[model samples]
Target: MPQTCFELCAGGRSRGLAEIVTGDGNPRHKKVLQQDLECDIVGRNPLHTACVLGHSNIIQEFAKYNVNMNEPTTRGYLPIHYAAAWGQLDALRTLVELGADIHAVNFLDEIARDIAFRYAKHDCVEFLDWAEAKHALQTFISSVQSAVTEQDKGKLHKDEKLRCLSACKAKNDWLSNVKNPTRQDLINQKQLLEDTLLPYLNKLAGHPEIVKSGKL
Candidate 1:
């Protein structure tokens, strides 16, 4: 079968791709392409094909249109998976920048990094390792921020207050210890924070008077 018009346009990364997709009056073609355009051969959509071909220019075009970066192929492999498998570092970074989920796993339960490793793409693995660690740190930071808000504003029993305060102090200490820390440092510190706080939070959740108590 010949390549779909969308695939040709995407593979070429031409402005014509956008023109063709948007100018189509059918609407369904654009919708189906954006959401799910499965290829019988590779089960890859335009975006997936762009990644496999390391067509960063085409990917930038998709990013402009806010294309679905996480769209999975027939094998449940996302564009990032193809980028990793092909050791396309620029494409991988572009995907991540455009909000691709680094944690996304394929049908084989393998993440992008895992696929990179399987292919012995050492540089890709290194970049993925750093990206994963950075993502973990950012996630931990967001969680800690939310936890802090809960500690400060959420109603808690007096005993729970002390526990929250302790957790806060521990969080502060962990922050203080890290001075321009690397990704591994953040990973380790995040684990420590979780260990110190999660149990206390769980225990506090079991308190009988939690809901009844008003904000202190």
Candidate 2:
């Protein structure tokens, strides 16, 4: 039997929400979803119900409307927790790809991966492992990119502000004594000294006539 939108939501029908909506950005429909449509049996929302039922298509439809994947139940269990507990591999994978927190803990202080492992869902456990590794790699890449950008900015400032050869020589002498200095360490030292040195360097470079006359 094809349940109506209200009936399906209230009853936790897995295919109800997706089948009802046009997915064309309807405001009324969005409002309906935003409401607390609790399933009488399980007390879960439409998205949570679909997750427990392992309905990937329904989950995708919910995601189209920017559904909250981390929405917790009364028990503080997220959709990811249900997906793992029910051994719904596809549902779990879809949630992970959509940026759900794989490490999120439930009310019982149990993570989704731990629940899947306890339920002996070996495939889900393996998928979670891969997902975690992929996330870590992406974070590392982003940090490296930021560091490169900072280094470039530091080099530009050094070139523009330190115009006098004597000023440059003084900076080099200070850097040579810093133990275990990395590229970032050099940039930090340059930034710390920039404000103090820029004005003096600018004065010396501007008054070339005074410097040539050797009048101190």
Candidate 3:
């Protein structure tokens, strides 16, 4: 199959190879790969075009070249925003797996989920919602672990350490079992964990060394 302009431009292929494969013989085509060229009309980069076309393979190719996955277009639309707007679920999933920021807002202050919802892309909306919730839960879990390991070391009493560890285990278990958690579920669990750990966190805060470490 013939490579699209996006594949040729973003694939990081040699100019000679691109010329041979594309057979376009346009010098601007060479410049397109050598320099990150934007679309004339919308000013979208090659990665954005790949997402708009729902080309997951091309998106992965962009990743191989260390292309900025979260880089927005001239209009402030990320590759993810393009995928969401175009209802490209597979492309969106690829971007998410590659660590694209799902929470990023465009110039219009609309997140990818908002774009998905506006376009009536229910699957994309659901996936973005779940992805955001999962990311938040994982971040909270990491913070809890870090507090126990880095912040509370030698500071928390044995009983307090046990309590924090128990709470962490419960959160891990909850995350393991959760299939599709809502944002409200994340908020509730976070609040519960905060309530459980607030006393210990406060105790740590009182320690001059702990406060100095800035890990709290």
Residue 55 miss distance in model 2 (angstroms): 0.3
Tell me the TM-score of model 3: 0.66
| lDDT (Cα, 0-100) at 137 in candidate 2 | 34
Model 3: clashing residue pairs?
A: none
For candidate 2, report its TM-score.
0.58
lDDT, residue 13, model 3: 45
Q: In candidate 2, what are the lDDT values of residues 77-137, reduced to their tens digit?
A: 8889999998999999899978898878987898898999999999888777766654543
Q: Residues 1-216, candidate 1: write the lDDT tens digits.
A: 434545664557456565545645455665645443455465777778788778877787777777788988777899999999999899998888788888899889999999999999888898888778767655655554454456554645657556656665665676667565566776776566566656444544544342233111
> What lDDT does model 1 reach?
0.70
Candidate 3 Cα errors over 4 Å, as ranges: 1-4, 7-32, 36-41, 150-155, 158-216
Please report the candidate that would top lDDT against the real structure. Answer: 3
> 46-88, model 3: which lDDT tens digit per residue?
7787788787877776676677899876678999999999999
Q: Can you give the TM-score per candidate against the true fold?
A: 0.65, 0.58, 0.66
**Comparing 1 and 2 on lDDT, the stronger one:** 1
What is residue 112's positional error in candidate 2, in angstroms?
1.3
